[model samples]
Target chain A: MIARLRQTVWSGITARVRGTWDSVADAIRPAVPGFGTVRRGHVALVGVGPGAIDLLTLRALRCIEAADVILYDRLVEPEVVALAPRKARRIYVGKEVGAHAWPQPRIDAKIVEEAQKGLRVVRLKSGDPSIFGRVTEELTAVRAAGLAVEVVPGVTAACAAAAHMQLSLTERGVSDTLILTTGTCREGDPLPESALHARPGTNTVFYMSVRQAARIRDGLIARGVPDGARLRIAADVAKPGEQLLHCALRDLPDTLASSSISGCAILMLTWPKEVEALSDPTVATETVAPVSAANAPS
Target chain B: MIARLRQTVWSGITARVRGTWDSVADAIRPAVPGFGTVRRGHVALVGVGPGAIDLLTLRALRCIEAADVILYDRLVEPEVVALAPRKARRIYVGKEVGAHAWPQPRIDAKIVEEAQKGLRVVRLKSGDPSIFGRVTEELTAVRAAGLAVEVVPGVTAACAAAAHMQLSLTERGVSDTLILTTGTCREGDPLPESALHARPGTNTVFYMSVRQAARIRDGLIARGVPDGARLRIAADVAKPGEQLLHCALRDLPDTLASSSISGCAILMLTWPKEVEALSDPTVATETVAPVSAANAPS
Candidate 1:
């Protein structure tokens, strides 16, 4: 009984100590200063969204404005980059097919190098940094150097494309699972066979798949995906020259051939009949005018 | 030759007129007004991000502040809802297990009703609205009523949990595919058998899966997923009292038992040896303090 009483007393003391410690820590914690004046030796991985200035999160904007040096990529819009303070250094380390101005390892090293120089660094990517953004390498490098790191999520291309199209990736009783994948696999590293197949009640979005349209079509067809399945290809999404094409799965290659889609594109596969029927005709007419005109053969 | 020349001249005139019309349209397009002054009868479907107020996008925050009537869900943070203008009407339509404060159809009707009344309606949801936000129903309803609608994407729980963990959903040479799915399948809705299996070089994240831990474990094990696979559970992510637990796949049930996990949680399955090796020990130690303390039995 005495032992149990002693244990209770010790537990009470421990709880009170922890409570006091938490209060002290909360009181002493530093407040986040205004943008353009972040503490040195810290790094913020900010997502700039899908090339639209307004799509940028307030937190991402604050990070960009506060950074002493910002490293950006090709897909990020110039207008979005302009949001950085005039005093901030802007370095374009864009990577295009067959040409990488700055390779991944080099980019990771540079972020760490800048942070170690007592400068606030922002490694900005176009979409949500955690998705296809190669953030783990940079995050690992930064933390290894004992620098503070934070990731700010942004609108990925899939979400932006859906918003621009006024479509939902998942609908109750239609699609419950939304899978976001890329078509551009590394050399000798092919995606799983299951990844190519379109499952029922699930929406599949293929990023960087414009160039591989034929391969995707053949694979899906081999997997028994109906030729009549609907596909939506959005190019330069959310931009002024944005083009959206809705066609059958079998027409994906033909549709690509008809349009000059030589940039980042999102290929969405959804339930054809249900989705098409649900789309508002007025919205479709308004958004599809440019694309329809562009697709007209002279 | 005379006929061809006349045709060319007429086409040139048409092109010039169209160009002039385009320029005028661009000049007269309405600029997005400041928050709290959105045009009436318009509805903005805004994603409020996963619980953190700062994680909200600039567009989302603008929509919330500008809204005349803000309809929010249970998962959205109170601070985020508080961002709405003082005069704005706030209604809670949160969905809890066995208790939906407002049915979906009713919610849709209310949003349409408010919008038709010439009030700026903001339907705020937790995470990117297009993903599992039931946006299609609302979008269809608003468009059917001939009301203006716009969608603003925010950081989903998957992205926020990834950011909090300092892990990337996709990593080159390690994980090329990142699949986001849910564990709470509706009645008569069973997930595909293949989804239970962990693919090589892929990361699978299950949102709202804490209650389904045993089912997930059994399914994955049945699918030949190594019992030693790594599992990370993040509860109340990005909010105060957030808990993160990292354990082997087999230990999922036991680890969950030690924590007070009730609200929204993210279950992340990553490759075991490689991911654990890649995570920085210092960062892990710093972030795991609370979970480690919570897990210690008295």
Candidate 2:
């Protein structure tokens, strides 16, 4: 009887999905919601995962093992780059600000140069390669140069950070929206209007924004976001020197200062909807009293 | 001189990270940022990537191999569950609607029961378990049961969809924000106020929402989201029967109706900051010209 009703309700929905999906309407899901395209290719863009080599996806490992040359970013640990065969040339294309830094275009050209040589090229990035990783530019370059390139998705840092912190990026009703955005933009681009997007039912994780901590905090405060919008600062997540710290939004700048944290950090700003602890049976006992989520019964 | 200048500029930045970090100020990073906590545990919450078993992180694979009792969701492929040792118990905790469904509480209790028996319990969820996975409830249950639990992150479906489409979730200088939100809520919860959060510079991926396609499309149209806001839908992403389709926002309803896509899909709604194709040198030639992002020079 329920199946009949469900079928009637979902007349346009595919029966295959409806059979397995409770949402019956849940038409879509993100298999790995960052990036993927299985194309025939000589060059591959691979996300090596955040910090831990163990976190690397099987696809990433396979891509690395098959590479004849690897152009890796700075955050990619040497140990990860070492996964390439001994004969593979490991080029350090780390984009730090010093003399060793390769500008975005240079990195693009180098990848193209190697791919044009008919060598298997791996453009290794930390975390999922498609988010805030300037992948479009490289992707554009590879295409413009007439090389077949494929992107192999890997564990993004945000997911890893949340896992390490024992936190969920999106809480059911409390935080229905999860936003991943960079805290900083291109050097000359206008500072991201980070505070402008705030709304109920939204959680934002800022990537590459620690130096702008003070400004970001001020913007959120100026925009009247409550201190209840707690800040979770995770540093070197999953790396040996990882640090997880929590504070109100107001303490963001100081937390980074005193925490001895380095780079590759994400600032998770969440304001889980307030719920009455006495009235809500689903409120977790271990959650911070003010910002706890209501795991309402389904 | 440049190194010294960079050093002076990065006075507060951790030397360890700055040596490897370009931002020098990246205070925290997501090393697979969905959900993770390394605790002493017999119960493990494992995210098994979106679909493909090989997409599973090394950590997730390890957790499954070590399990004495594996409780998996519906989206988890049988090949994945079969990875457990022959003696391991494979329990189906998938909460599909209908008589066979297991309530969330019962599933939690089952896990607790298994753990109390000194069994290695693996709570396997597809995609990253931290987002929209009802993990908090399960995590709470495990904690309340006084059992040590660990959450091993996995590649989410969003990453997989984007990769399959050869698209990036967040584009620099354009769509800097990526929002991951589900289409439907629990049976009783209010419909997600998705349109209210629409703003420039944001890309949203709607998970488990294909059933709500019409309503969602109506909501977006009502909220005045332009047709320029394109929709890319990928169904059964990375699975054997994966399908990738694209349409304008107004056409979302019909697109799904016409496409034979089943479940395990994600709706990727992207409004890449409009760029003048002629002026933006870095704009991808292959990108839909109207929705292309300005790959602005850094």
Candidate 3:
């Protein structure tokens, strides 16, 4: 299969296929026809999962297999990009690991520019694009230029991290709400404050926030989040070199500073609704009711 | 590929893979050795996406293809279940479909029973199992009995619905936080309160909440969520008969009552942080700045 992808991608026949394939999460909207007989190319803003090839959704894979050009981010695995047809063009729009890297604006221009040439383009992102993927800029740019685009959702890192720990992000009584927020904000925008977030009865995951660990800790503390709130920090989620850490909210900064995960890590805090203090001395260190025989009622 | 899955699954090669597979998000855990060499079966709690088969993650498809005994819910598409090996036992534990339907507690018991028999059990749920999938009960049950289990995450419903609409769920300047909560609670559990949730500067998606439309609307309104806040309601996301509605928070109940979508629907509302009011009379009907050229600053 890998060899086939290479052959197809490098096959030297680069003709765009227009919605010919079935079962790949067909574009929700029909393509708007271009005026004056000018052919228009299609772009698929596909998420390739947190890191692992296995986490890649079938729809995302299908989009790559049928692409005439693939513009991928650094988070996408090289093996995944290798799956495109041999006759396809591959471009790197990520911050690292590519000879032909481009920034966000350039990517917007390139996607619209390439589509105008009537090529099948795939803008591959890492994880689901809906969260912290800078999706607003790209979607606006594409739609502004009157081209057809579709988003193929992929498994986000939080889910992958939860799965890796063999735990769920939200539990029945422990947490009824799940928040998908980011540690960092857009340039020139105000940094996210914990006072505005960090709800009780919630499991909040902060993406791209490892660098702001201290700020996050202080902010949550300022917002009156319990000092002993449970946090699950993970990096390189499903990819090799995976690291998992369990600590209290107060220990987050020290724990991360001493650990190896950087930049790519996700910070998840579970602040259970005010619950009875644990009477069992064995597990007294934790706050919420742990998912054990001791608390089987939840 | 479909034929290959059938062969591998139905081939009666039921011996557990035991972390032998190279990829496929190979369980992040090592097997706990059973005492006295009593062979133990494994259970994989897999999320099969909202409804579409293509939205299924490769890791999930791998689990299903390798399943020895498959227990699937109603939200999972039939084609997804059909991919399991013909020899593999396929059981339905859903309330709406199949003759072998069983309730939640029975499922917890059944999963433990099958895994103890040394079968590779796949407990398939719709959407990401981490969110409102009742994972606490299931995971606790499996572990209490000293069995091994893993979770394979899939694209959750909110992401899928956002993708289907060709829009990003979390857009800059418009919505900073994304909350994934549900409308209904457990039989004895207290219902989720919008006052505790429904924050400004947040985009909240309610899963399995169509039945609670009036309650959700009333609660949000009472909590100061603007009556004209933009809402996007979608049902049967990514599957046939998919329906989408865009309305104000106040009209949610009435709009849902007049729509074709019933059950299996998600409701999303974006209550922006206090922003400057628009002067244009045409699109003034909306509270937040539109995503058009008029509001591209975000």
Ten-residue region with minimum lDDT total, candidate 2 chain A: A289-298
- Model 2 ranges off by over 4 Å: A1-41, A274-298, B1-41, B274-298
| Each model's chain A TM-score | 0.76, 0.76, 0.77
Q: Alpha carbon lDDT of residue A176, candidate 1? A: 60
> RMSD in angstroms, all models?
20.3, 17.9, 11.9
Ten contiguous residues minimizing lDDT sum, candidate 3 chain A: A289-298
True contacts kept of 1: 0.38
DockQ measured for candidate 1: 0.16
lDDT for each residue of candidate 1 in A103-139, tens digit (9 for 90 to 100): 7789889999999999999989888889888888888
> What tier of docking accuracy does candidate 1 attain?
incorrect
On the 0 to 100 scale, the lDDT of residue B269 in model 1 is 78
TM-score pick, better of 1 and 3? 3
State TM-scores per candidate: 0.77, 0.78, 0.79
**Interface C-alpha RMSD per candidate, 1 decimal:** 25.0, 21.8, 17.1
Most DockQ-accurate candidate = 3
Better by DockQ, candidate 3 or 2:
3
* Top-scoring candidate (lDDT): 3
Give the per-residue lDDT of model 3 (tens digit) for A1-298.
4444333432211112122332122321233243124235888999888887768876787688878889987777787787787899998777653465677799999999998899888998888888777777888998899999899887888888888787778777667788888777667878766334665567888888888888987776554455576778988887767899878778888999899887888988876644322222222221211122221110
